[model samples]
Target: MRIVEAIGIGVLILLAALALLFLRRMVITRRGGTIELGVRLSTMVPGRGWSAGLARFAGDDLRWYRIFSFWPGPRRVLSRRGLAVDRRRAPDAAERLVLPPDWVIVRCVTRRSPVEIAMAERALTGFLSWVEAAPPGESTPDTRPYRYRAG
Candidate 1:
């Protein structure tokens, strides 16, 4: 009986935590048109696949939070400066499972390292605009326009 009761309590706690996380994400999204778009991220490892997450534009940086994590803070932050968009393409067969439906993957190089992210076409446009929106008098990292490739 005690074991069963403990299990029930643990389940309840887990549910409560999940609810809190959902509420937090909702609040953040509701504030100031915070676009909570789905994205898939990839590192520099060869054959390393993509991981799903939610991305939002926060100030001059793009903040990424894992889809399954309960943490309130972003897992990765990509700065605007030193950001260069290399290319974009339609996701392949295996990538379809990890990326959002009808989204394209963008390859980019940041100050720290090279990273790839997938998002909807509209969101990708917005991201490019954000990167190029640096105010006058500030030095832009890569002047080349973002180019999309046929896949």
Candidate 2:
């Protein structure tokens, strides 16, 4: 019947729309990284809610993610210059998205470079722990040292 055919066409159109949306999100997500690690940024959502959802998502993902900061390390300090920097503007290279905050930034180094990812994992873990324990109005120190060092 014509109604049946129409319904099928409608369903196909809906599916195509969804697929395109997902693919677009994927492309947007994949746009940034570095020689050391590729970074991904999530859409700006409230930090608390986003963090909670990410913790749950990580339970299912092979790669782990956690909130992190650079602090208390002698070489690392938080300053305007240190946080979520665009990597491409460096003296030597073309433009690239270096470290945009994702609900999680996956360590995207070549599979051979397990060391790079491991270090990021450790720092992220420490930052997560710090955020959980930090009390209201407690001063959180800078994490620029560690982030800069990693880059």
Cα-based lDDT at residue 11, candidate 1: 100
Model 2 pairs in collision: 70-142, 70-143, 76-145, 77-145, 78-142, 88-96
Candidate 2, 23-98: lDDT as tens digits: 5434433533211222223334322111210121111122222333212111111222222211111211111123
Clashes of each: 0, 6
TM-score of each: 0.80, 0.26
lDDT of each: 0.71, 0.30
Report the Cα lDDT for residue 118, model 2: 18
Residue-by-residue lDDT tens digits, candidate 1, 14-132 = 99998987887776566553544544444454435566666778777788877677788888888776677878777777667666677887777776877777778877778888877
Off by over 4 Å in 1: 36-48, 141-151
